[model samples]
Target chain A: MTDIQININNKTYPTATQPSIANLKLSLNSNEFICLVGPSGCGKTTLLNIIAGLDNDYDGEILVGQQHTHPKIGYIFQNPRLLPWRTVRENIELVLGEHQSPDVIDALLEVMQLTQAQQVYPERLSLGMSRRVSIIRAFAIDPEVLLMDEPFVSLDAPTARQVRELLVKLWQQRPHTVLFVTHDLREAIALADRLIFLSASPMQAVSEIIVPIARSDRGNELAIESFRQQLLQNHPEIKQLL
Target chain B: MINLKRFLSTLSLLVFLGIWQGVAVYLNSNTLPTPEAVAKVFWLGCVSGQLPFHLGVTLLRLVVSFSVAMLLGCAIGIVLGRNKKLDAFFDNWLVIFLNIPALVTIILCYVWFGLVESAAILAVVINKLPNVIVTIREGTRALDQDLLDMARCYHFGKRKTLIHVIWPQLHPFVMGATRSGLALIWKIILVVELLGRSNGMGYQLHLFFQLFDVASILAYTVAFVAVIQLIELLILKPLDKKALRWRR
Candidate 1:
């Protein structure tokens, strides 16, 4: 487990004259779940893209530390982007290659209740199933820093909860830095160890607050609702921004 | 289900043969031979190995031209599809080539390169290349960016990404090109051979036509059509089934 430091000097989308991300500095402790909650179109995904090394146009440098020079990254986009032609198992095995044993896939599939669906192509899988397959794909890599950008947005509540539980289980099984992005504040409170609220205009982290509830109690709807109401009441600024 | 499909296919072919037989009988002329006469000629040609030889020659030409066109078209198409400026510049060139008549290309190739085997193959390849490039270009343009991002994030590298991600997405387009390539090339090869080549199915058919040997021409036509059907059954169909089993 290693802390990751991200320093974004600036980022200006070519189409837009003004910078979307400007001088945003963020630090993530090792083995911590950090949720980046923000308004819609706040460039949260772009920040994740920069961190995952997908977008090179951003003026930023992520320091993954000296001990581990080449840290592995796993990303889950807003949509389930599994290859339509690859089966669930093959999609997971794509990340493994010659690096890890096939047993990890088997174990993860078994845990995620996707063992039966492993041989099925992505098209045959329902939306919920496809989302689960993608989640398995991300965790199967055993990534050093997993960046998820609103993976649970379109899913129904029960399915989303199931997926969230599975994600938490996977995170508990491994020690890695997770940077989850979402627009929903309750979801952030339930999943994130520390919540980082992002402002829409300048697109930078505005405030950081620790989740007061324990991991076990996150499943309680009343507890989560009460916490959400109290946080919004205490900080009227965060409420409007959210 | 497979057995039923095969049965229906056999029935349709039988009905076709019956219709041809009826038509030829009604005509009762040297220009339209009966099925029995054509079948006898076909049998004799096969026993003597003349039909097989000409067929082998034409098949070799088709294979060569098809391979070259597909390879070059896929490469060029991928390049143009990825680069917008290059695609825009070459866009009109593709349209021009696509619109040019096959007869003109064949005649031009023979005139410029002389009546040689290479010229015949080049003429066929040039005729077929643009269609392949266009189909594959559309596929390349339609490639899912999200899947590509997934591949990049997973560190699949260039080779793995191509095989697993890019290739599968392009499979339909490649197959479309191949099937159409086979159909279009076989027909164009006949024209090319008729125009220039000394030996091939087309050359033999030309000889039969000049002699007014309707039975022999029909015999050779039957043999040619049978071979193409065999290729579809033995090679293309199985390949298609295997490659697209993942698709709904």
Candidate 2:
């Protein structure tokens, strides 16, 4: 894995009232957990869309690793976004393609605690369960770059925490460059190796701070909050962006 | 609960048959034959192979025209739905076709193409295609973009994306078209047959009507209605079950 370099001069959406993204430059290091923290409606999702090659209308360049092209991408949208017709196992298996059997999915489903829901369709799943399936689907493909857009935003507390732990565990096992976008600073501090704060419309990175806490101690909620407090005190410039 | 529903259904059908028989006996005329007279005619027609032959011919026409219309409509609908400029250009044409009467199209196809089998089939398909296109076009417009994005990010190829992501979203609309199309196309096919074709249920019905054989006409009608009812039971119900299995 290598760093993902994103350089955008201007991105004006035809439908948007304001400029979408302008003069945004970001570097996500190889196999590292990078979180982008910004206020809601700040065009973070649009940026992720551009990086994932869903919206190519933007005037920008996204380099996955060293190559100026999309590598395999695993994206988790803000909502669960699972296909309602497909069962949980089938949803993950779909990404594996035709040649590969679903044998690999068994272990991952076990890890995500979704083995029981393998045959259950998305409609029957709880939001939390559906989110886990989405996570599993992304991980199933073994993507080179993973992009997540506020995946844990609306879930209940315990469920979100559990999914976060599951995501960290998955990343620990198969390390890849992750560009996680969210407005929750505490959540970002809890998960990131480095946190990048972004400004409002025409999004540009305002501040970049390396999380001081070790990955080993990130599970401690109190420690994460204290570290966030200390980091905010040291750098008051990002407070406004947050 | 299922058994109770079945019992009620049987009772209603029996009551209907009894009322029809009672009316026929009260009238005591060949114009309004008893249920038994119609039943004998139906059995004789079946045994003599005339009813089966005409029914089979009509069914073949229904299948061919329905398949062609649905395939053409769905393809055109997707194209119109995805391309805004093309849709704008073609919107007036679709509106014109939608408003054109089925009888007019059948008559025109017969007049222009002559009383050939292809002309008859073409007429049914022409009458049915616009409705399917409009229904499927609306469905395509309403598709969830988030799911589409998910499909794109995962690199589901065009074929996989169409089958897994696109088709399920369009299934309800397609089903709507299919049921309505089946209802409509068969009626148009019968008219096509009555106007020009030498065989099929419509031709047979015309022959019965000319002879003033009410029993034979009712027999043929009963056979056609039974086939439709059978189609509802055997084909549509199971397909509906499969499509909606994902729902709660």
List ranges where model 2 is wrong by over 4 Å. A15-17, A98-101
After TM-score superposition, the amount by which residue B121's alpha carbon in candidate 1 deviates from its true location, in angstroms, is 1.8
Candidate 2's TM-score: 0.96
Determine which window of 10 residues in candidate 2 chain B has minimal summed lDDT: B182-191
In angstroms, give how far residue B86 of model 2 lies from its true place.
2.1
Candidate 2 residue-wise lDDT, B6-59, digit = tens = 999999999999999999999999999998999999999999999999999999
Q: What TM-score does each prediction get for chain A alone?
A: 0.95, 0.95
Residues B1-248, candidate 1: write the lDDT tens digits. 99999999999989998998899899889999989999999999989999899999999998899999999999898888878999999999999999999999999999999999999999999999999999999999999998888888889998998899888888889999998889899999999999898899989989998999999999998888889889989998998899889878
Candidate with maximal DockQ:
2
Q: List the DockQ of the predictions in order.
A: 0.82, 0.86
Evaluated on chain B only, what is the TM-score of candidate 1?
Answer: 0.96
Best candidate according to lDDT = 2
How large a fraction of the reference contact set does each model reproduce? Answer: 0.91, 0.88
Q: State in Å the error of residue B68, model 1.
A: 1.7
